[model samples]
Target: MVNVGIGLAVGALLLFGGWVVTAGLATRSVSAVNAVFLSYVASLGIIGIYVLLARRPITGTQTDLVFALLSGVFLAIGTVSFYGALTRGDMAIVSAIAALYFIVPVVVDVVYFETNLGATNLLGLGLAVVAVVLITV
Candidate 1:
């Protein structure tokens, strides 16, 4: 439970940080792709420094590295899409729509991943989706 709360807090911080960075990029640049690419480069530099200081060895398998790279690519694309949306749409609406990604992991787990969900958990997810809809609408 504590971990869950911490994860939520971290997720909120990421969203807020992303929004601020995206807004700043929009003010200075016209290309969302450029902004996302530069952001990823900066993130990579920061992460590399952290990993070096932590003395963490890169021991992951090729498949794992591939997946991680794919995740980074998708993140860059998503960031560009998000910034473009923010530029064209209301920030509140865009942010709420972006928050739908939270519900996606649950859906993916339950459906494609064949994971089980309790009745209570299903209800909670439903409520969350409803809340997102309400907030965005």
Candidate 2:
């Protein structure tokens, strides 16, 4: 059995750590696009190996496929934009701006998923925006 909360925590931790490393290493490269591309290539290799080892079927329902493809597209766009921003600005500032990306999912959940958008959630969202500003400055 898997723990969803643990998975989320680990995933978020990895994202933060990976971004920090990417910010530092990408600076050594001349082209941010190239850096992003190379990272994806490496991911391909890792994922390929994992698929081979796990021996899981590389198939899914139409819904799964659509969402998986969309995830890849969104992540690719986000990573490229983040790397480009990292090259041109402070890592903290770029990461803070990137954190604002959460707002999209939250809004989508409220509007489409019929999620409860309580006052506490609204206040948290406002604080998130304020935090980005405070941290960047």
Candidate 3:
């Protein structure tokens, strides 16, 4: 359990670091579309190297590959959209608004996966939504 918690914390830190680098690159780039495309290509290269070095065999079904591809597509769209939003809107406002996406996955997990949304979780989710609303308004 301790290792799992540490792993999660490290993962979160890495994610934020990635986001910071991507956002800075997007801001500096002349074109958001190109930035997003190049970012994805860079990510693919890193992941490919990791897979090769780790010797993780790819055994996923076609459906799994399709879903993974779709996820990449969605990520590309999101990256472009976020960069565009940041260019047109205040950075703080755009980031706060984008944070609302947290609600979508939480709701989906609760509804589709029948995950247990305990009282504390529900309260936290509600507070997050409220914060987004307040920040935007």
Candidate 4:
């Protein structure tokens, strides 16, 4: 319970901080591309420093390394595009649309991974689609 709570708290803090920074920069006339770069680099530096200070070994197996690299590349593309949209559109609407990107992985799980998505999961997916439509239109 303590571990789950810590995870939830940390994840929320990270997400909230990311959104505030992105929106604040976008509203302050910073170009979306630059904002993405700034945020990415700053995050890398801050986290890297922390890991170093903690005397932790920065280690990953080969498969983990590949996945980590791919994750960073994929995230950079998405974050850059999202920040770009934020610069030109209402944050509320843009974020709602961008948030729907999570559906991709959900779909991949069902299609590619053959994961069993129960009725509740299917309904959740339907609701997510409805949400995107509501926000977009």
User: Best candidate, TM-score-wise?
Assistant: 2
Q: What is the TM-score of each candidate against the true structure?
A: 0.77, 0.85, 0.78, 0.82
Model 4 TM-score relative to the real fold:
0.82
Of the candidates numbered 2 and 3, which has the greater lDDT value? 2
Which window of ten consecutive residues has the lowest lDDT sum in model 2? 21-30
lDDT for each residue of candidate 2 in 15-115, tens digit (9 for 90 to 100): 87776676657766657788888888888999999999999986999999999999999999988888888788887777778879889989899899999
lDDT of 3: 0.79
Please give the range of 10 consecutive residues that has the lowest summed lDDT in model 1: 20-29
Order the candidates by lDDT, highest first — what do you get? 2, 4, 3, 1
Query: In order, what lDDT does every prediction score?
Result: 0.77, 0.84, 0.79, 0.81
lDDT value for candidate 4? Answer: 0.81
Query: Compared with the true structure, what per-residue lDDT tens digits does model 4 show for residues 96-115?
Result: 77777778988888899999
Instruction: Sum up the clashes in candidate 3.
Output: 0
Worst 10 residues of 4 by lDDT: 19-28
Residue runs of model 1 more than 4 Å from their true location after superposition: 1-29
For every candidate, C-alpha RMSD to the true structure in Å: 3.1, 2.5, 2.6, 2.6
Q: What is the lDDT of residue 115 in candidate 3?
A: 94
Cα lDDT tens digits for candidate 3, 1-137: 56998999899978965775567557764576676677678889999999999997877999999989898888778888987776677666787888677788887898999999889998988898788888888
